[model samples]
Target chain A: MERTRAPFAALREALHAAEERTRLPVARLLLLVLLLSVPLWPMVDSRWLRILVLVGIFVVLGLGLNIVVGYAGLLDLGFVAFFATGAYTYAILASPASPALQADLNWWLAIPVVLALGAAVGVMLGLFVLPLRGDYLAIVTLGFGEIIRILLLNVRGLTNGAQGLFNIPRPELGGWVLRSLDQWYWLLVLSAFLIATAVGRMRASRMGRAWEAIREDEDVAAGMGVNTVKYKLMAFAMGASIGSFGGLVFAGFFQFVNPSSFTLAVSINVLSIVVIGGMGSTPGVLFGALILIGLPEVMQFSETERLLSVINPAVPFADTTDWGRQVASARFIVFGVLLVAVMALRPEGLFPARRPQARLPERHESTA
Target chain B: MFWFDQFVNGLTVGSVYALIALGYTLVYGILQMINFAHGEIFMIGAFAGWAVLLLLGGSAIAGPMLIVALLAAMIAAALASSFSAVVIERVAYRRLRNAPRLAPLISAIGVSIALQNVALKLTGGRDRVYPRVFPTGEVGLGDFSVGYIQAFLIGSSVVMMVGLIVFIQRTRTGRAMRAVSEDRATASLMGVDVDRTIVTTFIVGAALAGVAGVLQGLWIPNIRGTMGFLPGIKAFTAAVVGGIGSVPGAMAGGYFLGLSETVGRELLNELPGVSLPNEWRDVIAFSLLVIVLIVRPTGIFGERVSKRA
Candidate 1:
């Protein structure tokens, strides 16, 4: 075990050293991120802005998932269920499409409803798999995700079947009509910032330590007087609440809700983010979203055709559409392979979450 | 009579699921890992069977000659699936044997994705028609008629299940498999040839899946790359509902799940104003899984479920 970790320790040291070199404090880092993105706001077109919004949303999702899988050591394969629930909840109660509501609710008003729904569902999931751990939990959660999607797809009158809900009323902030993509983009960015801050602080809290202990070993965690079940449920509720924010923003941005948008692949993609970025690393989640979501946008069909066509004039543009579709389909394969490779090689992820070195063993012994 | 017909229909589908579920049980017994890619392996078997038919003068030829061709296709499929299962174990699962239990499962998901994509690529995302090698005709009256394909599926699955039990109880390789599953290190120490036994467990499990795949194609008359996924999940659900590592439990669970599905749909259809769309039939499996988990986490037959899969 030590041998397996030797390389990672060295890498961690190198990373720490690099951080020391660029030793910007938390306030500076936040300001730097905000300042750097200022140029991108005006330069990017709506298409690019849409991609950026998705990236931010994913980052938020990754962070939320990081709390569960990373800090709490749970493998949630059905997380998209909660995301779907949040989005669907928003669409149902806050849109004209829902005949039951008959009135489109305000975005601010809908946010709490969505959070409460997400939290309730999260608790149900936590309770459902209270006895299950690891792979069993994963598969059951996967079933849960599928069940939600199947329900959404089949509930004809309510969900509008496969055609999906469209033309959702734009979100309003105290009577200001928030219609532009830029406004929604900022909403997401702001949400991402808020969620990340909450998650970051949660990671350092007493409850957070209990989660870490549970993640390391449930038996030991329980032995230490930690209410493992309650904390586990709390983690789920927290992650769900954060993810619901993403969903609410998602519906607002597109003014659309579709069952097609939420799938196992989405859950897996967020899992990959939590994984590839760095399990418990807040910044890692952001980086994970950038690579997983942003990289794919770059590789989308249109981009692929232009690049390929430029390289070879004889290449027919029309035929490249097939190539594009194949590539799009192939992304899951790549992600899957990447997941296997990454988990096997570096389970700690690209940016291993930094724990306080001096405090590690004392916590372990205390828990013990 | 409507209920009886649905019951019969459920039994036919149930047998195939039982065959697939057996694969899950066998692998779970030995390695204690959920072979997520097992379904794709089943799909591969179907495709291999289809390829054999195409090679052996296509579907245009029929009669006694077609039976011989079909037997050959079944063998090809079993062999193909067995081989693929071994490869998956070696490439994706071997290294993670002692790692966290979740590692292998995640890796298996990767293999599942890769294999499913391979199938999609090969079939060009379309369902491949199984050459109608056998004359499929109903052999009953009054809407209670059973088709030859359906009979063959139930009969063959039963035969296979019985054969597996006999092999396990009576054969040396099977004994070694049981020994390894009981305790791998001890089995290795006791000269059980642990690695080979594990490989054999995979082969046997995958062979069953392959046969199920062949039966499915023959029964449904269409094979697709993605076909393994739904059945695979259903079979696994069957395994879990029955008690994951229990062979008999998987069989019972499969039948129960299958019956519930058809019967539930039948019941829903019969109830006025509560007729759900046909697509909601898929919900039966998911709901049953949740119900079983909530009611009996260890499954009906399982003595105990490990904290992990």
Candidate 2:
């Protein structure tokens, strides 16, 4: 009797190649769907448009965070600090209510300043925690975030303390001041698309490879001549800059900026988006933002209220007329449960990024 | 006299921080992951204690009955917190043992948020007021005075710390815990039930946090669902300052932070042009954490953490 192998290795390799071939088209199709939705923005209800805008903003934030947490593997529980920095920077420059540093600045000029400031803040925080690793870095970053919030609350002379900044002027493109939901929606969509494209390119660059190495094993990456410190700082700066952009838009949309608005919750929300969206996957981020941010906003509809009440009449409601608000308030609980469930059941996330494949040397016919 | 009063206050606060820090240290020792939800366990403990106190007549109960009620509350709180911690370990942490480091942390944060919101929903987002049970008065020794509750807090904290030290040094489970922390794979190979040991670690830490929660309620006289957040952060600071994963270091760190916030703040204010606000205490604590990490990443009593931790 003779024994023979089934050529399992070659079969697996072929299957993987097929998967890689199929994934690109699916990703492109998802992007196409997203881009095709642009014209429908004006057709949707203003209320729904507002929610979509919010979703777009978070999509940008999620992509930014993916750079650090996904590509770099740094668990930054204090990413909100950068968000607050951007918001405050914009509010102080553009808001008339800014007590001490009111510049009555133009939003166009403020964009560069806010982003640069955001990157600087990121670099500063990055430097402080460079010596730390893993959980220590996380805790330290969290502390840094709290310190910023507390400073905002206490720095009465400059920030107007807990009163916050209000009456921020709407962003302007040339002579037209953007105020309507559709206008902001267009701006957000454009920015989201630009950011997505840039990020996608970055993910394939040498820097992205370095980040991937650092994330996998920092010491080993350093041993392999990957300048871990420089790359980590670059990740922080990049993530922070994009997060600040989210903050800038948030201020413009609401015409308000408060320390309370930029709490740990915001960081958690962005992080949840990145984690749930599939880390390094752009399409996954878009999907994540829709579920985490968009779903909650849509839950505020009266239809959702009716849907809920029919499901369980015993559901506790702080306000009967606005039952949707009550359910929306409990979204954090849902977020929590979803986080645990996702991590335990599918750590790779629902829309995981395609892992980079290493090409093997060609097999000789003699080997068969 | 003012300094003495501050000292007493520091001691009382420090005691609570120490107890919570112990839980952090113990868990970190074995698992090397910060149990971010540990603070919520402490809050649950307080709620459990509050429930018992309410059942036992709350503020109305007096004399010998007060002592019994207090004991019951402490025990109940411990059980509740231990239960919560065990479940968190099983549900949130157990499976992520070999997963990426970030997965368990994210799960823990999720648990923290969920537990906090659930507690908030349960309590109608209102503070659960603890009935004032201890008689109002200060025990004095020639201008150095301490409140009855403060004294109890200090005394019990010391007792627990001593008992824990003894247990860790002498008991079989304690030895297993130490062994697991030292080298988990080797310890398991040596026949230690790694899963059970991890669960025990969580239970012990949570029990201490639970007890501290009740003690904190007695002192503050009110407990809220959100009460655990700040204390949890502070206790983690204490754990880190004392060189995390070291029990004795945790105790030292807690007292150090407590004293610095109170007495140390006062001392700083004595400097020219220094009128520090009360809130600056938090800033000070965090700054201290940053400084320590920069200067001595291993903490005061922490061993060489460059290798594993």
Candidate 3:
């Protein structure tokens, strides 16, 4: 494992030759997949499953954003709008607030509706933002996101305002209720796997190459007869669709929908996962999701405080001290600092795509 | 008369927004970067003013001394914010000068979050009442009146804007700043000291924001760590509506945004069968942003650049 470069290279070469000789790529891939999924099954009763579901939600979100920002090179700061939209759609349909709709709607029936609505909204937003470029586009998207949240907050008739929609009906398959943490975890695992695979395949397709070209240089891509506007819109809609699907899962797991949950911070967090994970890599997004979700959970302050006091008798601060609360509150400061440090040090993120690039430039400088 | 009162009110608030938007405009004009932590500097200004008020034996002083004390607090606030702005420029933005657009933007966001949290820690997330140093009396003709603080704001903001116009149009340093904005590389090559110009741009912008913060203390008087967030966004919106990277555009945008938000709310309320909530007022500013981007694209005073990405 600690071999020098020469040995490691020789071993890697031998392994590749052996792999080619054996033609066991599929077998090895399956084995790797099995190894990943098998461990999740045991975490059924544990809180780890809850964390896994959280990571899965982000995975779907990161995958969604990867298409727009990573592949198409659009900087969208309003991604949470789509996520919130998807969640609210399901929440409104299933919650008791809309009894007429909920009494007849099943989870299976609601799925496609959410997906379609998400895609439609994405496209609608896409149309509005299509003409803009770079930071101007970013600000417009941010404004749109705030507008959605404010609209949600004000349109008390549909969303129940800030009180939020609770008692959202859980998904079911005939007689089986998908209510347990493990059940939700499995559902998310399947969803994440499906999304990652579909997106991964899509990344290598002709459409993906066109998107990559646009990302590299939209003008050049357009010069080459690539329909930049259409491809960018498609990327937006696709990203929105996937992101909203994630929102659907989040609503299902929590059995609630709130405007507060879908803030600009959430969008930034998802963006962080994508950017920090290596923007275009599917596996990187998952790994980022795991780190962001699991790391915070592992650093649960009260438990850490207890461990600290146990390890050191001279510890003056008690568990009930304001110091613990400060640390909890200070996590965001840590997160903010980390975001800056990472963007500065490694803009490529933890794992990078083929090209670790900067943001696309805007056309106009007269108005930012 | 009622409309007159509303008009006066809009102008007063618009003056405040203009004060805030000037910061956005100045920085954007020179650096082409949105200083996201600017709002936090505005907050810092308020806090610094509060500290000054305390240091001057409290806000309970009398008459001429009160005026002198208030002015001192405002100057202190301006200095504090200017210092903070320079620090943010050097530490967060300087290193990533050539990095992609996302890096600086994300770094700005990070600084914003960190500064806000630091403020929250300092204040324990409570809203502190800023002292009413300025006289609270209203003065004017019958049925057309303005508060003492509002008058002060309107008067001071105009003076500052006029003073700024003079500085930029007449001064050598201001000419250098304009030169940098026009072409940074060329300006640097031709003895502009681009870094100094950028730093000056930040200081001047931040100082206005600090003064705006003091006015916020005078106007609203209830200050909190998160107070800057909404106003910052609105000012940014104003900057855009005026035309981002345009000095006069930002000024015009701020006042226009302020008037529209106030009068727009009034107009919305008057519409038959429309019972829009008060929370909708905040959305007006953001909505204005979207509409401007869509319909105008170049904003009110912005010069249209015909290019595509």
lDDT of all predictions, in order shown? Answer: 0.80, 0.84, 0.80
Docking class of 3: medium
**Candidate closer to the true structure by TM-score (higher is better), 1 or 2:** 2
Sliding window of 10 residues with minimal summed lDDT for model 1 chain A: A359-368
Could you give candidate 1's per-residue lDDT for residues A1-368 as a string of tens digits?
Answer: 13335886665555444545566344535554783475366657877777877888898788878888989988998889888887877787777776455457787888888898888889988998988876557768888999899988887678886777877777777779887766666777777777777777788888889999999889888999999989999999999887887788788777899889998888878987887777788878887788778876766657775665455433555455455455655765665676678667865567878872323422322210
List of chain B TM-scores, one per candidate:
0.95, 0.98, 0.96
> What clash pairs does model 3 have?
none
DockQ, every prediction? 0.50, 0.50, 0.51
| Model 1 regions more than 4 Å off | A1-24, A27-47, A174-185, A301-329, A356-368, B140-144, B268-273
Fnat for each predicted structure, in order: 0.47, 0.42, 0.46
Please list the residue runs of candidate 3 whose C-alpha ends up more than 4 Å from where it truly belongs after superposition.
A1-45, A99-104, A291-294, A306-325, A355-368, B304-309
**Predictions in order: chain A TM-score:** 0.81, 0.83, 0.84
Across B1-309, the per-residue lDDT of candidate 3 in tens digits comes to 777777777888788788888898888777677788888888889889888887777768668889888899889999999999999898888888887556677778878888888888778889888776677788998888887888888899999999888988899999998899888999999999999999999999999999889887888888888888878878888888888888888889888888887788888889998876767776888788888888878777776442323
